[model samples]
Target chain A: MDLHVEGVKKVYGDGPTARLALDETSFTVESGQFISIVGPSGCGKSTLLMMMAGLLKPTAGGIRLGSTPISGPPPGVAVVFQDYGRSLFPWMTVGKNLSMAAAADKLPKAEVARRVDEALTAVDLAGTQALYPWQMSGGMQQRVAIARALVVEPTVMLMDEPLAAVDAQTRADLEDLVLALRDRYDMTVAMVTHDIDEAVYVADRVIVLAAHPGRLIADIPVDLGRRDQLTTKAEPEFVKRRAEVFTLVRRPAATSSAGSDAELDGRPSELKA
Target chain B: MPDPSGATSTLTSAPPPPPAGDKAPTTRVPRRKRPFGRRLVSGVSSLWLLVAIAILWQVVATLSPTLYFPPLSKIFVQFGQDWFTGDPSSLFLSQHFFDAALPSLRRLAQGWGLALVVGIPVGILLGRSAVAAAMYFPFIRFWLAEPKSAIIPVAVQIFGIADSMNVFLIFVGTVGLIIVNTADGVAGVDRMTLQTARSLRISPFTLYRRVLVPAAMPGILTGVRVSIGVALILMVISELYATTAGVGYEILLNQQSFKFLQMWSAFLLIGVISVLLNVVLELIEKRVLRWQRREGLSGQ
Candidate 1:
């Protein structure tokens, strides 16, 4: 399903105690597009993803899935959380976790089993049915989390820093794994990450969010023809895009409120689409 | 498959196969599958301290024999004579065994079982619902701190020294702690796990049954073990008053008659039974908490 984030705003409290978390942010994710929202720390990237997943509500404006505004988690939408250790149930086995998502969606028992099998196989974690998630390594547990999201055959997958917890070697494997799954399932994925290269390498478009009441600073398309961990990362276009994103991310915030607003709003209107 | 987005995104070679080494460490958790020789070695190592303690007890009793502290051999003889000699047809248990041991065991089981039945659900309610917790938490804590022994007189006045009185005492002694522990366990469920459940949109009933209860089990089981000790204490204390058929009564009867050896034997019997109760509870805990241990999270 295609997703549209209208001019949404989030403030934590009322009056003077209030802190702005997200500015009037707006973006659209076409169906089957891989979009990554990248930003510095405290940039409210996770807050934005949570809003799209319908787990958190925006204080102003709204989010819509294919013309219908969602007040709660819409049908055929699944989430992959960052803290896999806490996101997956510890007492349950890997297969049971997948089955849990299916069951919660109210799928029939036989169909639940079939989808669970297919999902695990899709993640290359077949025959890991009886293993508890805690029994597995960090990478394996995150794979279980991915399989859980896939088991529901979601139209939109919202991942919040999904690979931030794993080692570098395993993170590369998982990055490739996610790319493969996105292709196989044709899933429209919106991932939030702090890694600039990772955001550019995997996403069809990188949405750079500026911090301090996060607002969209740039939306650059990644047209690098091919993506491979070994070669694609070394491509000239890939390096150039990474440098551009890095510069935007590290750009100092103007002390004057008007200056900040002008900088964010001064982008070419065509890039907003 | 059709390219749904119309992007010519050809898949690269499939990701490398999942690592096999990930599954190797988990298979070693089935402790029972160890070779017989290794099992024997562990068993002997575990029991040596107990053996050393028993030997030390025997030597001390032999060196300083008193009327209250009879020799270990004499106490053993009394214990055997009192319990081991019996009617052959009735599992070789003596009449005295039926009078004292059976009644005590029955009371413990009934009281502890009732406490569990009453405590778990109430605890879950208190743990999960803010309104319920607010209403009952302070009241439960106050009652838990009040000793069960202090209420025995009131219970005796109501039930008049019957089996009901003993059961009431045991229930009062145990149920409070269980409820507290179970509530804490439920409240202690990981926040992210609960959020995952919410995002899945599972029913409230399924959430408690599948997620909350199992997650809180380790704490509940710890409460159960602790309650067993409490139940044992209340059992003896309640049996001390107007109770004709229990180990406590036997001990009192031997004391009045100046049969120090028999009194010591009764104390020994109670000690052995307490240890046995703990062993049984530990076994249940091991089975129930197999996941915690295997995950190497806690239980160490």
Candidate 2:
């Protein structure tokens, strides 16, 4: 199952008020790869991910899952929203959240139950089914959110800045948890994030996006294998790539539109890939 | 693990041990397991002020033979005589109880129940749509301003000396609270949650049942609780205006006859009903909103 965002553009309003959020963005996410869409605030990183998830419509062009054009949320695609506080139903127990996410497919009782248990187990939250989301720590709540996504048994999982809210330690732990779950499920995942270190750390490929009418500037392949918090980060190649993406991300956006276009288009030829 | 007295103590507080069959769990949720009996004892101890007031009222009313302020002893006697003259088969409830108190209770229940049934959906509609809110909100405000006293007499002209009139008046009195609160609650559900529901591909029906309604429940329940007082007030006033069989009518009747003891008893019954309803509502809220209270309690 492949995802293609072909010539996607987003405009917020009309006439004088119209603001271009994304411009002529095109990219393809191959099956089962973890891609991180990373950039600063006002960058359309989240906007791109939302379009890919079929939660938002592109003003022009289209997003497609396999051969089918994404008009609405396609089956077997799920989103893990960033704000854990605003994601899960506060009134529902953890198990209910997961099961309810799956209830849309109208799976048989046993099958829905199985998916619920399996999803929780994937996040190491199996025994926490009975607890309401608010009963858990912030980190635990995010895990529940991940489990909720997993319950859909998605072929593709789109996450929008999922770790932006948690503490440093929780963020690191969750980063690894997401990777482990990705490997275990063999699901294609696109995570939208702001941290350069995190974007390079977890992604199979880091898709660099620049702010102000966000568009892709560079697509770097990450070759590091079996990454961990310490040594993988310390590797020469890892440091080089991290520094490359960091510098590219940290470079000040041009004040003028013409200036930004020249500076922002790092590799326009590779963007449509 | 089902402890009938709402005891969580018997449920182990220990984190469900990380399963050996899988990777160890990372994030942990701390579960509190306080003894229910201890909680009950401590909770009961806080009612000393209420007891003190009751005792003081009894002593003061006994000493002063005021016409309006009858002694507690005499009021109790009147209550028993007016309410308990029925045979054992009828639970010893009197005919007067059936004529007044019971009718008041029934009208309150109907009007409030109808308002809830009508109000919640309308509230949800208003909450979900700015167009609906904009259209209906001012109308709701205007109607809310006109008190039950004006509503009952005017409405009686149309519905005419009927329980429906009383019920309709109560509904008019309380529906605004429910609608406003419910709309607020529904509107309060954040953007991400709605987005999550869409991403999960939740069907429209399931979205309302699982996401929209539950998310707005705290607001809905708050609205429900706020309206109880309004509903009670409207119930009595509705009876007072029209030809009716209710405690409001009886209170007027007893007052005109100068049966001050019975009037006091009627007022006492209203107080008891109000207290009982609040208590019942709190109990229901504790159960219905167990998730909400659980978080609040965990902080304590």
Highest DockQ: give the candidate number: 2
Per-residue CA lDDT of model 2 for B149-248, tens digit only, reads: 7776678998999988888888988999899999999999988789888888878888898888988888999999989999988888777777557888
Candidate 2 C-alpha lDDT tens digits along A1-273: 999989888877766566777777788999998999887777788888888888888888898899999998889988888888778888887878888887778899899888887777666566677777766667778878998998878899999999998878778868877887787778999999999899988998998877766777778899888778867889987899899898778776554232335543322222221
Which 10 consecutive residues of model 2 chain B have the lowest summed lDDT? B2-11
Task: Give every collision pair in model 1.
Answer: none
Best by lDDT, which number?
A: 1
Model 1, A1-273: lDDT tens digits are: 689999887777666556677777888999999999998886789999999988999988899999999898777889999999889987888878889897767878899998987777666666677877767778778888999999889888999999999888888878888888887888999999999989999999999887776778888999876467889998888999999999888886443132336544323232111
True contacts kept of each: 0.35, 0.43
DockQ of 2: 0.36
Chain A vs. true chain A, TM-score per model, equals 0.93, 0.93
What DockQ does each listed candidate score? 0.33, 0.36
TM-score of 2: 0.88
Which stretches of model 2 miss by more than 4 angstroms? Answer: A255-273, B1-57, B294-300
lDDT at A23 for candidate 1? 76
